[model samples]
Target: MSKPPSPILDLSHTGLLIAAHGSPSTKGGRTSSRKHAETIRNLGLFADVRAGFLTEKPFIKDVLDGIHLPEVYVVPNLAYRGFVSTTKLPQALNLTGEVTERITPNGHQRVHLCDPVGTDPSTAKTFAVRILSTMDSLKVPDTDTAIVVIGHGSGRGRESFEHTNRIARDLSRFGIIPPVFTTFLEEPPFIKNWRDLTRAKNVIFAPYLISDGFHGSEEVPRDIGFNTKSEIFIERLSHVQPNEMNQDGQRLIYLPPLGDAPEMAELIINRVRASLT
Candidate 1:
């Protein structure tokens, strides 16, 4: 017996709009979102693919207004299903629910709103691969190493904190790496207090964010004990071999955000495909 052919995905009649929380001061946020759109555009699945931001030019509202496709899918390119993804983005797009239909110049239009990429069940697995690869490159062993997954926790709701902790827990259960810890910029057990959370000799800081925006590029580095005088400073650190610091034999390694990860494009596509079902 032979394996059956894989199912074909066709969305030639639909348009995709990636809604993101952009930063005017940092280019990484908008740049990553547009990069994802470009990656998906080359695949030619959707009739059109474009990225829109909340705090940048070509805003979400304008992008939605320009799209005239019979069907549209709005996927929030956010890290967590927090206020930005579930509330701000939806309100900007005027979405009533998961599926919103309205009369427009293009006749009857249907729009599907997808959950944030980070909320996908497979996200934890993708994240694990990145962490394992990073560790392999550093020649670091799982013993005596603590992994801290940091997120931009929200005060408005517990969604951000909950999702971050869940991902951290899931990563820990994999047993491939050392103990995984959850920290945040806007919540308790903050990134600045990593020493208080765990006692691992070697520490790895992984940012659980979509992009190296204000939080990732600026706050993360500062919290992890680096001088973030400019956004480009963090980029330079990423290129440094062993991007770690030694203090009395203890080591601290900082990993970049997941925005540039190749797996992210797949995660976005999975979110869109799930909406179709």
Candidate 2:
């Protein structure tokens, strides 16, 4: 005869933990984490939502230890798959379940590693829309303005830059002819030749980045010049702290982080639900 559904299934509790490459200099990292947590909380889907880090202060161990939830799902807030996403995060969290074959430390927490946000198509669309909107705000004509998608280009893994380039290429189909070029802190073009790369006098500098930390605050401006003569749009995915902006005029507009966008929250939820099956 058919028996009643297992009682153990009813006792199961699900949790979500977002892991990011944490920042020590600026509070952007924490802000992103908080926003993700809040989104999950607002949805009321999971029993708990927590945040962890791969580097710099409040390590993964701390986050795992702090969580009271029994079963947890860890979503890496990283854009690309690299040391942090592939090795560092998994090693630190010691996650095990349907994904992990063997046992490791912190195995008590049923942790599932969700793919990085950047890999999601929704994220790419969101970034593209934001960049385009930022350019529109600058009164930079689509024909004249050249959109430069500045990413933290790296020699280690081409994934980071490639993802940005892919987004740019996809958005190009929408008639945004703004030339999308990529420069790196470690690679060539070096943010110095940004103007030369795209011969458009009206250039929209959008950092295809998530946070406004070292790269966003100092390096980007230092090399590219803080001259607001040309429109500058910093496309970040985290909230902008008051100190980050010194509003002189509308010449330079630091658009809100992609995380603040409700679209992002929807993307995260969709990603989670898709992975469940």
Candidate 3:
């Protein structure tokens, strides 16, 4: 009875699940989840790390059923949209308005669900790092570039859009760069208005989504006049080739969705650890 030093945790008996509301049309979201799950599994953190989805094959219930451990942890792999974080995940996992759902088989299976992992304030720092790195790669000074944190703002979940703004504000206050903007695909001050509203000559666009699916990669880029092919967006983390683009008078830099970044995998691990306390 000694704990493995690899994961550095005594949760060898536990199974970890990274849960996402996967895309039905595009495999990007689910594929990213599986990639991250594999990354976590390589870390030897739990008995197993599995990706579960609400819309794709290998559904949440399927993974839940397959995990034959007494303690199972499910981390919501979402951007903290009110719908998915509050309603969809709970309903799909059959929590019945509880923090966890218990099932008794041989002894018992205690399934603990964690909150939205991507939209946590901790990710603000990660976003800042990504922006800085992108700026460095483009040879653009951080102070000279404005950052816009983009989201698929939902009117049904106004809180989700507000959270996007909060991340932008945090990035601004944290001094990643001044002139931070928050815009969306489905709401006001949208992507089309990026040039009109933003004060900087160069802008770094960062996605505040779980995956670079249809919206983040293709739809958003197309709206911004990049006009990339839809098929390429499905598997790409960074949609626009060559990173930076010159749009007449202004410069545009696209950063991959946070969910696709390695930092996000670390954040997911942190989320699972947080649930332990």
Q: Write the per-residue lDDT of candidate 2 for residues 161-191, one digit (tens) a residue.
A: 6776776677776556767776767777677
Q: What is the Cα-based lDDT of residue 94 in candidate 1?
A: 88
lDDT of 3 by residue, 46-162 (tens): 888899888887899888888888888888888874788778878887876535657656567888877678755578888777777777667887666687778878868688688
**Where is the poorest 10-residue window by lDDT in model 2?**
1-10
| Root-mean-square deviation of every model | 3.7, 7.3, 3.7
Best-to-worst ranking by lDDT: 1, 3, 2
- Clash pairs for candidate 3: none
Q: What's the lDDT for residue 228 in model 3?
A: 62
Q: Taking the tens digit of each residue's C-alpha lDDT, what string does model 1 give over 1-277?
A: 0221232567877999988888888764346788788888787778999999898878998998789998999889888877887778888888899999998876999989998888788888878877888788888898999899998887899988988888888985555558888899988888999889887888888889887577876788688886677445655644422256776567888777876575687778788888767
In candidate 3, position 126 carries an lDDT of 82
How high is each candidate's TM-score? 0.90, 0.77, 0.88
Query: Model 1 clash pairs?
Result: none
- Stretches of candidate 2 off by over 4 Å are 1-12, 28-30, 96-98, 101-108, 227-262
Worst 10 residues of 1 by lDDT: 1-10
Error of 3 at 133 (Å): 0.5
Kindly provide the TM-score of model 3 when superposed on the true structure, using C-alpha atoms. 0.88
lDDT of 2 at 154: 78
